[model samples]
Target chain A: MGCDIIVEEKHHVASRTKNKYTKNEYTGLPRKTGLALRFTGLWEGRCLRQFRGRRLAWAGLVAGVLLMAAGMARGEFIAVLYKASRICLECIGVG
Target chain B: MAEVGPGGMGRIRRTVQFAALLITNGYWPGLGRIAIYSGPAKGVCVPFLNCYSCPAALFACPLGSLQSMLAAARTLPLYVSGMMLAAGFAVGRLFCGWLCPYGLLQEALALPRARRVRLPRWIRAPKYVLLALVVLLPVVWVSAGAGVPFFCKFICPAGTLEGGLVLALGRPELRVNIGWLFAWKVAVLTLFLALMPFIYRVFCRTACPLGAFYGLFNQVSLWRIERDRSRCRGCGTCVEVCPVGVPVVEKPNHPECIRCLECVKACPYGALAFTMTEVGKQGSGGTPRISNFKVRNGR
Candidate 1:
């Protein structure tokens, strides 16, 4: 039994050395790759470090869309955008 | 071996070139009014986003005109400045190199052997942040796409002092309604303009949203100035000479880089070179890489 124990320890050491020495092919993707793939336009510098970072940018985008849709669906906001654009053009000398 | 040609010569030539471009854009002949005539026709200005709105403006100033376009846009292109983005992608940030009238201002301010002031990191992000609040925020808010000219309304020392004040001072009606915003603008303008003589284009380096816009072009532009690591000695002279606060050793296409060519002027070796042919010979070949490249950042 003692000899079997010694043999078992030797096998473990051999496997440890083998694991250390082996050079595996780079088949696996790094874990961070998943995170990077998921986020877009959030972390421009990094993966979304900036203020318009994911949360705010998304909220703003949603608000902008809703505001726009509501305005389009309704009346007053429709002409206001058009009118504002015209005024802006004229002011900048393109109107 | 260095980034640009010799300091004094490259600086002078580029300065003269910038002045010529600005004049071509329209600086009232001597003040660079000529810039107005050439920018639209010439198409040589690829780096700096020139204003297309100024009556005297010959070349297109991207930001100034972009704001107007956004304010006016009622449709699908929504939020994106197609032409502007293309131009930026094509040349990256080369406009800071060849064109920018304001970059020339900082270079000129650096003259008469004056001491320069380095801005703190706390302020550097403000320009980009301001870019958001000024450009993106409004576009998102309006949903009509594109941004309101918030810089002009709230911050721009140029518009406030150069155009607004100039127009307001001449017209009484505008003066009549001049409320807190005007005073606020004028006070800021006064401080920045005053600082211009002493602190360099403190506004451009620190606060100019237009500069920030152009800085976005630094990465992909063709004949951009690049640092060849093999040739660079890691000397910090480029930083010392840079008016807009770019760290010389890193890379030229920084968001803050006005493409003034000062670091190109500052380099001791010919490591940095502005090119058009992508991988061709440096300045000695003199192919004039501009003109042909489309302003991809625009429509």
Candidate 2:
């Protein structure tokens, strides 16, 4: 049973979908890894290792979207428009 | 990372900067008359420091929007924060190097042959202080029933130049309203103008709250600079070329780096590079090493 589970795990890992760097729709290899590969060619592994925390960037993108939605829902978008459309004399050092 | 030779990279940067300026402030109603754009686009905040009241500005300044929203509703500025975060993470301070019209003006002031003022590292602290005041003063004043965009009124030289000077030139009658406050603002603008040539983006390095905010994301931004320790010789060429005086070899992802790529073009070993993807390259590092990368003069 343990051997069967090991086989299933290996299959699952192998069955992962293709990413941007994948060779083909089904194959696994870099088709377009990063600019580092195109540029230095030698700095490829370091480039990928340096980006180990790229998941943080993705999370930030999602959080930013969510915050924008919340702010718009609360009518902040109109508030921004109302304020931006008019010239506040104080802002220009006149008032 | 194909080395766009010195002239090539500079030409590309200048073109991008000029294009950004035109795109942000392109609302030309007529040649003579000046009018603020109040269209639906004004609701959207552009990533840089273009003033809202500029005759042709199509979008709101994020700093101005944040302060106004905080003062009016006395609540958290979720929208501006999110917008800033998204832009910061996506491109970091690329906007400062390539998009900010104010930065363009400073660059024009910076003559290539002129001597630069070597400011102490402590000079980097004030922008954060200004940012703090920008966020807090609005809430503080609003709670007391005197709502105001504090930084816009007191400190923003961009507003003074783009909004005040431009509007004053177009509307003769508005000149009558100019008082001590206007004079004070002009003085502030003058100080910035005088210092810029000597300091190389002094306003951006020491005063711009927007730059300060975006600087925080330089480390985690989607687009980033990477330095290869194995390849770098610690020659300090990158440090000398950096406009913001970032110690590039020591800290390739420093907060102050504007990513102008001057260092990348200047490096003899080609130790520095920028990447746009997250995928790592795994292989028998192809391409023979070029120990003496030829960096032509004027790089």
Candidate 3:
């Protein structure tokens, strides 16, 4: 009975290892089979495409914050404050 | 979770829009005195277009600030650009749907049950042109003092209605300065107001440079609409319900979609949804994808 239990454990380990290697690292689709052996590149491309928008958004948000900080440091806020506070003739469609 | 219907969502939106209007222009003390709010809040730019010259406006308009910054020093308007980028990247034109006072007014106009027609797709191009040529025109022809804010001076109906009319009514002294330009602006404002009932967001779809600017980020905005193709029957309900005419099933995150969420609520199959994150399991391509695991029974 003990010997049979050991054998079952070994089979389970083998199957897990097989799955780890057979699945694509990114997409988890079946990796390469027959002529489709070049699918590694395709899987990587798909992975990148999936997350591109999210990555770009984060990068843009960071860039915006930094730029805004720089502008504030340069007293652009003061300029905006002065301009916004005053009633401009242009804003009122005058002249 | 109990999902809110289009009616509930619309009421929430109107409430938010009204609250935003009041919060931004709540200073009633100087409402009829020609004395505008000159507080520290005026430094911060509001995402949607609100005329700063209005007596009660407590914050700056981004478009106005952008033009002013550009026309004055001709340097990159880093501050305004940064603010716009942050807002756009975060939520795209969500401001247009839920916050813009003008959008609210347009919706109110649209509610009167006029001849509503789906605007041609080509109508989306003019705002971009206005942004490129008119908004940026002041940068080149900079005058001596504060440079000319071209869009405000010549085009903006909000400036005419909120700022010009209010100030003119309040202060008789300022009305003397009003001439052909004011008349021209009034005509333009009247045209837009008249068209709003029939066409639905006529100014926004065709001429709002601010909307045009924010629309660019719709593809990559953090907040987005996703359609579950697994359940979507392609019944055209979403398309039928969309106020901005976004072909929801075909292109869910179309630039014109203002994220009004009417499509999501109106979809009988509960296929469309608003998602905050677009990272995992979502498609960056125009058509959103569902994972194989998520597609029940290979349907």
Candidate 4:
């Protein structure tokens, strides 16, 4: 009984594939291959589209926060301030 | 309330550049100590390409700071990099457009009525090479105790102008140290200045490593130019007006765009607009709110 149901499901998918290929007659791809390709393209597009609005904002925010944290932890920010505060005569070749 | 043209923005930018130059080099007019401003403010890096060696400069050049930091101990240039990152994220190469003294000089020189020539696209590659050679190589060489701020020492016209020329003019004692290096830099500056009337911002388009560095962030910077596809007529007006020759209809935020907003003002169809996203404005969708309605109103 289980085997029969599984076979029926496969048959249903094959028929749907054939119908799609027939509707777009110019594709020339085999039914299974065309279905697979379409599914892949759709999946990729969906993934990329998800990165658009809120996700991008979050990513930027996170990156900024992490960079700040790193800057602080390394005392890099202080070092920059210290360097900028002093004069390097060598930089001007005056030393 | 008259509709301002790109020329108006150019005027505004020129004024801002002049103001910045004065503020950075403010101490000289008073005649107290005309040496490099070795004050506390020197710890901060200004966004423009002002040379720190200038006797009147109040802030450090980020590139010079970066090279100095790197040459010290392969020290991670946290302050310079962080400042650059912040500036890049905030406004990208808008610094080049409205703040850089050198850019201002180029703009001023370009005012002469000359037959303008468009630079070939491939010339854009050399700035990246310069960034690598002048910035990255020195960083690597720093580990060997051979690291020098090669670009500033050899190639920077700002240093030559503000540090070399200004110092020589003001002090005259420093002229004894003037050698072939100074002459070479003067020659380079002369070549760039002569070319400016014919090719707008030739140094910026070809060899400004600092501009190149900021340009990398143009694509994702909070400050951006947007083209409303709905309004565009594909007339190519923006391309004609762009100083850097960016094809804005195709790529609205081309890295080469200095964010001078000439295209924004030049768009006949009211398609191009400047916009900015609020920092930390969460979940606001990637949609940028229109910041400049003038372009939209097409006045």
Candidate 5:
């Protein structure tokens, strides 16, 4: 009786997988076309699911902050500072 | 927590914007005379688009600074770009929503109107084109020693409103310099002001290159609005309330999202929220919350 139950469970799992593919094949496309469509759908699903992870976003922020800090340390901001102190002639349309 | 309605949030945002304007342009007194603050703090770049030449302006405009940097050298505008990037990453277009004086003006004008016209999606593309034109065309002219900040001199209504109007009014000597260019700018500013009531943030939606830059970072900014997919009912309230007309349910973190949190306040099920989190982790609800996160809606 236990052996029979295991066979039935395996059959249920296989039928569920078959149903999933059959749902995708409902358009009545050629076999090769259906396979291609299924592959594309799976790829897109994977991409959308993976795209939401926060690690890449945090990495970008950290990199941007480090670059900004480095620029400040190197005195790149000094030019803007000096320029801002004096009146800008061209900006006012007088120069 | 009770949710603040869009109107309440708008008032708070306007108050902050007004405060920012006063702080940045505090030198202006009620008297007819106006004095530009030539302080050390002026060297710092503000994230918004206040005119650098405005007599009362205390900080530099980033777009103007970028143009100047490019006009002076063919190399990349490292300092200005870096500063803007830092701001963009941290808050996205939060500065536009909360700090821009012009944005405040548009929002104020929008308040009195009963009717608003929704712009088509294609109208959003021009700002990117304008950004390219403003940054690139002037570089070539600068290389030939004939370049001006083309956008500022030719197009920016902010410069015309803050600098031109104030200078023409306060400094009689500068009045003689007002000619066709000033006239042209006045016409543009007038048109923009007239359109504000009918169309929300027309300049920001269509032509503000700074908005375009900040919008680029909205997808990855530290502060963001997220929708809990499991809880969302797709009632479409967020779309209706959004000033920029973003389809928030489909893409909550769209680049065009200004991080204004209007959708968060509008969500009936509390499925939407504003949070400080990594880009992919926006829906996790695990990060620190921004102060004033609660929005109380009036019955």
Candidate 6:
């Protein structure tokens, strides 16, 4: 009933959805299983469900930073690094 | 993880810098044609504004760099800057929402706080007045022959406070020339640095002119937050987590909101979201109770 209420309320934006997954949508994984996979880091989902908690998000963020640092110090594709920083600075109008 | 693609507006900055390094004597070390002059982008001058004083910044920021440019040229390209001002007037601080590295830095610092500090109703307007003083005042007053860039010299936490000032500090001549306004900027920075761990992005809420500009875009922004009161149990997680003190439940589309989507992330019942009005139609309660976020007297 709650989900149905939400679905009904969301008719405005949902109407815009050109759902490719219509008939035989059952072939797609169930909501629970998809959510579980997302929590397990097999795929990205909503932020609330992403890592189950802040600890894991911290863990992921730290690991990602360390990996980037290691790669950056070695001068691994300096052009790519330069380009990314440039883009980061430039996106706001100047870099 | 939206992997931002290449071949965007960014390529120009990188390409120019790279070409400059190659053509100049520094990087190439005795390459042909040593005289490499790298200045602000002239073709499309922007007056809308940003923290262009950043060392790596390529474009001239309208608010911060305007006096110097006009003083240098005397005859300004009045129409070019007009387009950017039009964009700002139409959309407001949309640039801060979409752009602004300093704003991004505040967001990053705000991330670790366990809870957010909601601003009192009284604090929101100071930023608008600041925008007028910093951006507008200089344009009007500088004609009287003020040598210093009024906004950059007096206020701008970005220019006087950030890494640019730190880098500039290394030169003794620059350090000696630093005045009271620089001290004020440092004091503001010191306060923000002190407050960031406790509250989040307080500067963005209270002081940042760029943020003030961007807040104007909140209602019309393509990416925005929406609340579903039907599902909300009024848990207050969204309010508790918001760094900018946005009253999510009461004013989801409030102009002050950066549209960071932190509230959307905090809503456990999927009551809040960053959306372009996906499902909110036919009797949909977009404002939720949790967004009001009041403390219980019992607690």
Per-residue alpha-carbon lDDT of candidate 1 for residues B1-299, written as tens digits (9 for 90 to 100): 11233254444446566675656455464124212233224222223534433334444444554454445553323223444454454454545545565555554555433335667778878888887765554455553354556665666665553455544555455466667777777788778767766665577667877567656756544335666554455546676777556665665666766555656555554445543322212323232222232233231
lDDT for position B89 in model 2:
85
* Over 4 Å off, model 3: A1-53, B1-7, B112-116, B144-146, B279-299
Worst 10 residues of 5 chain B by lDDT: B290-299
Per residue, candidate 6 scores C-alpha lDDT tens digits across B1-299 of 11111213123323443443222213221112221113423222332334343334444455544444333233332332343334443334444544554544454455454133556777777878886665445445544464234555555666544333533444444455455545666776677766665555566677766567657755544334555555555666666665566677777767777654555555555555554332233434545443244444222
How high a TM-score does candidate 3 get?
A: 0.80
Model 5 alpha-carbon drift over 4 Å, by segment? A1-52, A73-76, A86-95, B1-7, B29-33, B111-116, B143-146, B278-299
- Put down candidate 4 lDDT per residue, B183-251, tens digits, no spaces: 777787778878877777888899999899889878776656766564555666677677777877777
Better-scoring candidate (DockQ), 4 or 5: 5
TM-score of chain A of each: 0.29, 0.45, 0.44, 0.35, 0.39, 0.28
- List the DockQ of the predictions in order: 0.02, 0.25, 0.25, 0.09, 0.12, 0.03
User: Which 10 consecutive residues of model 5 chain A have the lowest summed lDDT?
Assistant: A29-38
Report how far off residue A86 is in candidate 3 (Å): 0.7
Off by over 4 Å in 6: A1-95, B1-50, B66-99, B107-114, B143-148, B162-164, B228-235, B269-271, B277-279, B284-288, B291-299
Per-model TM-score of chain B: 0.69, 0.87, 0.89, 0.84, 0.87, 0.66
Clashing pairs in 3: none
CA lDDT, every prediction?
Answer: 0.49, 0.77, 0.77, 0.66, 0.69, 0.46
Model 2, span B231-289: residue lDDT tens = 55556677766767787866777889887877776665555676654322332233222
TM-score of 6: 0.55
Which candidate would rank higher by lDDT, 2 or 4? Answer: 2
Candidate 5 CAPRI-style tier: incorrect
Give a tens-digit lDDT track for model 6, residues A7-87.
887984564343323312322212221212212222233344432323332343344345445533544223222322221
Clashing pairs in 4: A84-B42, A84-B43, A85-B42, A85-B43
Question: How close is candidate 2 at the interface, in terms of C-alpha RMSD after superposing the true interface residues?
Answer: 6.8
Please provide, for model 4 over A1-95, each residue's C-alpha lDDT reduced to its tens digit, 9 standing for 90 to 100. 99999999999888777777444223332332221222232244444443353344335545655665676677765665665545443455433
